[model samples]
Target: MATILSIIPYHFYPPVGGGALRCYNILKEMARDHTVYVVTSQPEDTFTSDEDYTLPERVVIISISKMLLHISGSSACKKVFNAISYRVKKRTLKGPANSFFLASYSAIISLLKDVKFDVIYYESLESVGELSGPIRRFSISFTHIYDAHNVDSILWAQQAKALQNERLMNYANNALQLEKKLFKCIDTFFCCSYEDREKLIRLNELKISGIVVPNGVDISKKPYDDDAFKYSRKNIIFCGSLNYQPNIEGLLWFYTAVLPALKSAIPGLVLTVVGQNASYDHYKALMEDESVNFVGTVPDVNPYYYSASVAIVPLLSGSGTRLKILEAMSLGNPLVTTTVGAEGIRYEDGKHLLIADKPQAFVEQILTLLTDKQKFDTIRQNAQKLVMEIYDWQVIGKSISTQIPVLLKEKYGGR
Candidate 1:
């Protein structure tokens, strides 16, 4: 088995998000066969000490302090600035302002100075430029696989437009430039979706070796009880990290356009929004209407999934495959999402999922699903079948594993 070093800004365990979840699942699978070392940032929770954050057996976890690296900023700004500075300096600005950058840079240094590995799996090239100098220094023989979890720069640009944030727009523009420069340094790249891969190819004009390994759900873990599946309740659930722009935007759209229509069609139609890092103002605004409920940061999301009659994804702008969609599908819930929201997943309109673009269309789709139990059941079964056969973590993990040997062979000559 090849030794693999993965550098992600965040780790799998604490303070879960989609990227963290994906990273955790993939690393766990990879660890089954390979010696995996992960360097990620540690969350600042008073309850959880350093000793509490443990890695899996045979898996190494390096936790970097965010305070030392100066990784403080609004989420969008943080990613863009990190991407740009990393591209130019190859070392992050030192201090509390950019700790994530410092953490990542330090981790790469530690890997080069302390450990030996066969392949370097770098997730999200947006901030990877920070390692360019160090990467060049150690660039002689190791295989480098750049994993683009999302077309981050594109998402930044889209968010900037929606929020009318000029600083973010400028950052997004600069990040795109940095992304192009960074792409050429990697030996191979992997994207989470076909749309992301295509955007990387078209925008960067780089024909680098890459594959689409879509995000997946852990199907082996038995789902929550069918009794928890409250088909009798007229409840619609939208789940995601509430702090994320795309999710926030999607929820706002649902609250503004779709919720009213659904309530009109089926009175007392309860809407549940569940996620972490939700601000008081955000929750307040959402809960202004008595029908909407904000359930902040649940330990287990299964109950939320089970309680829903339908799962809604009303994303206006974003890139990459959505884990929320996969999770909803894997749970056998009927989904009503916009075309953009369901961009990367292999689903056909009116088949495995119901895709609607306009607000009115979304409302109609939700109403249709709510009213017709037969059609809802059919879509739910189809979604579950699709996820089982195609989007299971085991299948997707193995696809990623198949590439590891090829990368190793290319670097070590069939070692």
Candidate 2:
């Protein structure tokens, strides 16, 4: 058995988003035969209750609070850092800023004074940047694993180009420079896809050890009836957190470009939106339209996925694999996503799901899903088959459990 430590920036129990979902599932699996410690965000921010979530036997939740910066450094310095976090949250809506996130090497190190962990899984940019200074101080040796949720530099550069902001470009440059330093401290990087792994290697111009661990759905969590799709309504479903900038950007783009034509053609067509809401003020017309219904933050998303005729992912820009795609596919909902939306996942267009980039093409794809019963059934079966064979969390988790120990043994000579 091994001792593993995971420090993610958000609350992961009963995970709401992709990152949180990945963290929760991975740690649960890791705790099977190992001692797994999680230091994640306070539940007051990401989630409120643990009524439904059952803890794994060997999994331990170490700490849950805001230690964003080096809280143990100095009183005045901590206040300054907290103030900067406040300003950033207030000024911009982009990025994950629900509250002061959970991240601090000093705080974590202090708690784990004498104990030595065999593996260190660092999950956010805040956590990654702090490891270089702290890991050197500890005499114990361990394999530091960096969980690359997305390529930070690329995502930041995309934001800069999209918004035409020089400040964002500077931030992107700083991110890349920080990664160059981070490369030295981290022994292995767990990327969501081989595509992301390739991009990271090309950017740093270094041959680094990395593994592809894709986002997955917990297939056996609840029983899903795939036959429900045959009797479901012709309505479309689009699910994602509105707090995220990319989801908002994608939805608004679709609403402005394709909704009118789709609504005109289907007459009674409705787009049901699910997930947490934070940014929808700019798109008032969407809320006012009778053809669109926004169902924000449901206790259960499986019913929504089961009831809809087809699920649509209209993302214009983002990185990493999307959990929504896997979730929809796992529950027998055929998908239509843009090329940007379909990144990272090894999805074959027209087989697992339909892909379209242009506005008219996207609309046509949705129309086809609604009209063509044979094509929809074929895609649905293929997608569900793909999920059962590859994207199910149980299967992926077992693979992760097997790989981590082997990597640690290979590096440290069977400690």
Candidate 3:
């Protein structure tokens, strides 16, 4: 077994969305045979939660070193120190010189002082953040594997364009430049989808080899009651992180364009927004809607997934394939997602899941599932069959377990 350091900006467990889930599952897979040491952080006080998350049995965990809080004076003095040191954090592009990220970088450097890892696995762009330039030297001895959860450059650029802010546009440019430098330091570039791989190669003009490690579902969890839809109510479920801009954008669109019409057509139609707690201020409309239920951050999403007559993803932003689509389909929700949501994943539009872009089209599909049991069951079964074929984490993780060891041996002479 090899010793590996899994580095990321956020805590992967109790994952609220695809990025965190990707980090957790991949590191869990690596820990099956490798001695994986995870270095991750919880978000600041505002977004922090008490939700319990159990890590895989064999992995070791390290919270980000709060060296910033180690000032030798009074509490007020420490505040003054942080204000003096990182007063510019809000002005800099996100992930560049953030306190936690800087501290995590410090922890990694401290680890490297005494620990020579066989592989240094960075989980996402947020994981690499602005530390790529400094970490470049360590790449000489360590097998640097970058698991890009998404092409964040494109996402940031889209955000920039949508907001039409000059400052955001500058930030987007910085993200592109950062990615360019980051790719140069990596040994293997792992893309969640072929689309992302194509975008990364074309946009960054990377010479490094890119591998597709598609997002997967844990099909091992007793096969979520495929027949649950038969008893479920007139419920529509949207399960994802509300804090993510894309999901928030999608929900806003759904509420504005589709939900009103859907409710009129199908009486008692309920939309339950699951996953992280959505702020009333951020999601004012979604919060106040009479037909919506906000079930924030459950220990297990299977109940919400199973109780819904249909699952929906109306994503208008973000890059990479959506794990929500795969997860809902795996649990047999008979999903209705936009083309953007289904990007780079293999599935038939009508047979495996419903693909809708416009308000009318989305309503039609939801109605089809809500009213017609046979159609719902057919799509449900087809989705489960598809998930079993390719999206199972057991299969995906095992592939990593087998291939990564070979790569390590070839590159650095295995332990």
Candidate 4:
């Protein structure tokens, strides 16, 4: 088995998100067959504690300092000073830039100074530039594989179009340029959706070969319990990492457009919004409606999934596949989602999930699902079957593993 060194900004076990969970799950599975070493950033609290990381025997955790040298919204003078410091001392850039540069720098230096690994698996393009300096040193040869979780450029561009704020739009435009430049430097790229892959091919005008390793569901967790499945309330659920702009916008849109229509059609139609780091302003605004319940950051989301009559994804802007959709499908919840929200998932318009882009269509679908038990049950069963056959982590993990040997052969020249 090849010695694999994986670098991610975050991992599983604590302070979780979809990206972190996906990274952890893939690395955990990879560790079972190979000698795996993971280099990641840790929470400041964990740095001082002697808590054992929940990882495989072959996995290694390298913790880095989370010190912020300069706050993100600093003045122009502060920005210039920090940029000089970062350039000269190789210190990290502030905010979102910090995790990418600092973690990669620390990991590359640590690997060069101490540990030896056959391959370097970078989870995203955030730190691809860091590898350039190390690659120039001829003695240490390691293959690089990049997992582009999403087509970040497309995501930024979409955000730029949606945002009214000029400063945010300009930032998003700059981010898109950086992402495009970064994609050209990687050896291999993995994306979550074919749409994203196609976008890259069109944008770069290159026949860049990559695989669509879509996000998956860990069926073992079994998100919905028996009691939740039997809940009588006609509930509609939207679950996601609320801090994400797309998710926040989706939830806000649902409340503003669809919720009133659904309430008017079916009296006492409950809408439960479940997620972490949900904005207090958003929560308070929704709470004023009386029908909306904002459940912030539950330990387990399965119960909420089960309790819902139908899961809704009203995403307006996002680049990749929705893991939440996969999770809801795995849990056997009948779903109503926008065409954009349901992108990349293999599902029929009315079979596995009800697809509706407009607010009126969304409300109509929800009303139909609420009233028609047979249709709801049929879609639920079909979604669950699809999850079992195709979208499960076990199946996805094997496909991801298959690529490793091919990558190894291309890099090392031997089986």
Could you estimate the TM-score for every candidate? 0.86, 0.87, 0.85, 0.86
lDDT of 3 by residue, 176-210 (tens): 88677665767777888898888777766666667
The lDDT values for all models are 0.76, 0.77, 0.76, 0.73
lDDT of 4 by residue, 1-415 (tens): 7788776665455426788767767786777777887666554455333232256788776655443332343788866654664564443444333434643565566575676666778876655655544443533467666777777766666665666666667656665675565445555677788887777666656645667888788887764333433335578888999888888888889898988888888888888988888777756788566777778799888888877878999998897888889998888788899989998888888899999899999999988887777787888888988888888878888887777778878867854
Candidate 4: the clashing residue pairs are 223-302
Better of 3 and 4 by TM-score: 4
Which run of 10 residues does model 2 get worst, by summed lDDT? 93-102
lDDT of 1 at 102: 55
Clashing pairs in 1: 69-98, 69-99, 70-95, 70-96, 70-97, 70-98, 70-99, 71-98, 71-99
What does candidate 1's lDDT look like per residue over 1-415, in tens digits?
8788887765457427888777777786787778888766655442143342344576776666554446655589886876676555544454223455555666666687777677787765644654545666765566877778777788889889888999999878877886676556777778888878877877767656568888888875536234433455788898999988888888887787777877888888889888989877756778676788778788778878887888988998888888999888888678999988998899988989999899889888988887777788888888888998898988887887788898788757766
Model 3 stretches astray by more than 4 angstroms = 42-53, 71-102, 126-129, 136-139, 165-167, 228-232, 409-415
Using TM-score as the measure, which candidate wins? 2
